[model samples]
Target: MTKVDFYLLTSHQPQIRERFACKLTEKAYRLGHRVHIQVEDQSQAQKMDDLLWTFRQGSFVPHALMDTEGAAETPVLIGYEGEPGAGMELLINLCREVPQFFSHFPRVAEIIDQDENNRHAGRQRYRDYRDQGCSLETHQLSI
Candidate 1:
């Protein structure tokens, strides 16, 4: 069974995003699950690298999204930079979209802003996953 979680970011601080990513990585690691993250650009990917190193060592995992070009198979698909993919145990959304990507992953989570506009988008994604028979949880993080 897959689980879904959504977190609302209180601020747009870079540290906050990194912190959440760390938490996400730790969660995945503790569960003994492999992770594949997708980002919009090299910069965001770099940011994730910094945070992920605390949990993972050695050469960074291949840029699966870039290398796979949405063709490869994965247990988790993250939509940060471009089109989001499903078929993952967990999907983490780092942006403020409606999270169409959640439909693909069995477990989906989004880090969204506290503002009304972004808040609804993240919550809607959570509900969509839940409606699809996924366990969903939401968190609010301070900046």
Candidate 2:
């Protein structure tokens, strides 16, 4: 069974969620886990790829877009579609709905900021995961 974690942020700003995703990916990568960030589309995927590079000062998280060459060799990958390569241990979902391939990973992270629409979607995803019998947890983030 996949372990699902919902990270709730206090602010509704979209950028906060992206930054948090980058931080989470960095932590996972440092801990020797392969992370695949699932965004909503190509545009969001590109944005996340850019954000991961400059999200923090004096910070570096090696990452590549899913379609690019050498993506398989990278510890962190960003994509909006297709299956991630084997050995991917974590899936960070930025999509509005649950990803079809989420269960393939050992851990799945869903980031939810304080936007009304986001909250509603998050609640639905939470319920869906619970209904599917996945182990679920929630973290209230002050940032």
Candidate 3:
């Protein structure tokens, strides 16, 4: 069964999700996990790709866009649609809705903001995962 972790943020700041995602992906990479970040669209994926490079001072994460060459060999991959390449261990989902392919991965991370829209969507995703009988957990993030 897939393990879904919902990270609920206390701050409602815009774009916080992406920033946190960068940090999360970076940590996962450092731990030697292949991470694939799924966003709403290509533009969001581009934003994530850029943020991963400069989200913090002197941060370096080896990553590539999902559609790019040799993405399967990269430690992290960002994509807007479709399934990720082979050997993907963790998935960081930034989309409003749960991806249809969520259960395929061993672990799925959902980042949620405090705003009404995000909270509502997060609840829906939680319910969806619960219905599927997957192992679900929620954490409150101070940031």
lDDT of 2 at 111: 94
Clashes within 3 Å, all models in order: 6, 0, 0
| Better structure of 1 and 3 per TM-score | 3
What TM-score number comes out for model 1? 0.57
Question: Highest lDDT among the candidates is held by which one?
Answer: 2
User: What are the RMSDs of all candidates, in order?
Assistant: 4.9, 0.9, 0.9
Q: Return the clash pairs for model 3, or none.
A: none
lDDT of candidate 3 at residue 1, scale 0 to 100: 98
Please write out the lDDT profile of model 1 over residues 1-143, one tens digit for every residue.
Answer: 45766676778664665566657755774575645455556777666755665535542332244345543554333335455433345555565444544455555556676567666766766666667677767676775
Of the pair 2 and 3, which is ahead by TM-score?
Answer: 2
Which model, 1 or 3, shows the larger lDDT?
A: 3
Question: What overall lDDT, based on C-alpha atoms, would model 3 receive against the true structure?
Answer: 0.90
Task: Tell me the spans in candidate 3 whose CA falls farther than 4 Å from its real position.
Answer: none
> What lDDT would candidate 2 get against the real structure?
0.92
lDDT of 2 by residue, 1-143 (tens): 99999999998665998999999998998899999999999999989988998999988889999979999899999999888988999999999999988889999999999888989999999999998889999999999
- Total backbone collisions, model 2: 0
| Ten-residue stretch with the least lDDT total in model 1 | 58-67
- lDDT of each prediction vs. the true structure? 0.56, 0.92, 0.90
Sorting all predicted structures by lDDT, with the top scorer first, yields: 2, 3, 1
